[model samples]
Target: MDFSRTHFELFGLPTAYALDRDKLDAAYRELQNAVHPDRFAAQPESEQRVAMQWATQVNEAYQTLKHPVNRGVYLLRLQGIDTLDASNTKMSPAFLMQQMEWRESIEDARAGKSVTALDALSDELRAAHRRIEAQLAELIDAARDFAAASEAVRQLRFMDKLIAEVGDVYEELES
Candidate 1:
């Protein structure tokens, strides 16, 4: 239980994009059981405080490793890269055009109260998200290409926001 270890190291998993969810879940459970604050209630005050810190670190590590997008960004960060920096806003032209088209479709669907159209767009975006995930696995796991994986992470961030917006529009239409 090294506090200085990265999330992947804490979970005893390889430092790659493609990870086994089951392994991560099991490791998290084991770590939580060991350091959960409640387990240290009768200990000395200093020990309890240290346990609380360990609990916080474990929870943070679990969260960062649980999500695909976050895992990718964290992996890049380990390599001294910052994907979320405002100045690092360089995406491909093709992806930008695709994003614009998707945005337009979402706007049109919401304006028309077209749940069916929104449903179609939701399916399309999901498929695109899967494709991007696959690309990220290849770039990060096989090629070890952090540069490409960084772009994939950025694209994934956009897809996540758009998907949430589509869900909101659906809720509005339903109401």
Candidate 2:
């Protein structure tokens, strides 16, 4: 109920990249049940307003902590780092080449209308995504290297976008 508390603190969780998802889910449900607006409908208007605010805060906290990418960015922000900075877009040249190759593969698959090829590409990208996520976990949790972790976050974001694009191609092929 303390508005100024960090999302992890609100959920009584450790402020680390590695988290117990089950714990988060349980805590979120408990908090939501406690402050859901409907539960305050019979209360005074002032109390209801407060409950609404609390509920909003709880939901935002839950959402931020639920996603691995968002949680990583939030952790960095807590340390006074902004991962979304335009200046932080510096990725390795090798990764740039890889991104181009991925785009080409996606385009080729789309052109061929090959569901099998697209599925293979999706699997490759997902494996890469998991590797990057593992790196993020180590960078943020063990090494405490926010700088490296931020870069991993950027790479993960790109992978997330690319994966979504592949999904779009699947839909287009289906249609």
Candidate 3:
């Protein structure tokens, strides 16, 4: 309920990447039940407003923590690591090269209007996302390597943006 608390603390959950989805969902439901404005209808306007705010906070926390990528990024941010910062954007050179190659392939496929090529790129991106998730789990749980996790978060964000762009290209081609 405290605004200053991290999302995990606010939700009364462990600050780890591998979360129990069912438990998180149940906790979210419970929080919504408690803070839902409809339940505070008999209270004063101030109380009702407070209830609404709490409900919004609960929903936002539930959303960010329930997802793997968002959870990892949140953890990194909580650890005082800003993945978006230029100085902290130090991904491995190999990864950078690989991303460039994938991006070029996506552009080429889209330019040629090759649905098969686009599908292949999408599959590769999906596989990479899975691998990144696994690495995120290990960095947070097994290794407790915040530094590595921060780097992974940056890479994942890049991958997400690139994937979305690729999807946009596919959509444009279809249209």
Output the number of the lDDT-best candidate: 1
Rank order by lDDT, top first? 1, 2, 3
Instruction: Spell out the clash pairs found in candidate 1.
Output: none
Off by over 4 Å in 3: none
lDDT-better candidate, 1 vs 3: 1
lDDT of each: 0.93, 0.93, 0.86
Error of 3 at 26 (Å): 2.4
Name the candidate, 1 or 2, with the larger lDDT value.
1
lDDT of 3 by residue, 45-71 (tens): 999999999998998999899776789
> Which whole-number lDDT from 0 to 100 does residue 120 have in model 1?
99
Clash tally, candidates in order: 0, 0, 0
lDDT of 1 by residue, 25-120 (tens): 999999999999999999999999999999999999899998879988999899899999999898999999999999999999999999999999
lDDT of candidate 1? 0.93
lDDT of 1 at 35: 96
Between prediction 2 and prediction 3, which has the larger TM-score?
A: 2
RMSD of 3: 1.7
**Model 1 poorest 10 in a row by lDDT:** 1-10
Reference-based TM-score, model 3: 0.90
Model 1, TM vs. native: 0.97
> How many clashes in candidate 3?
0
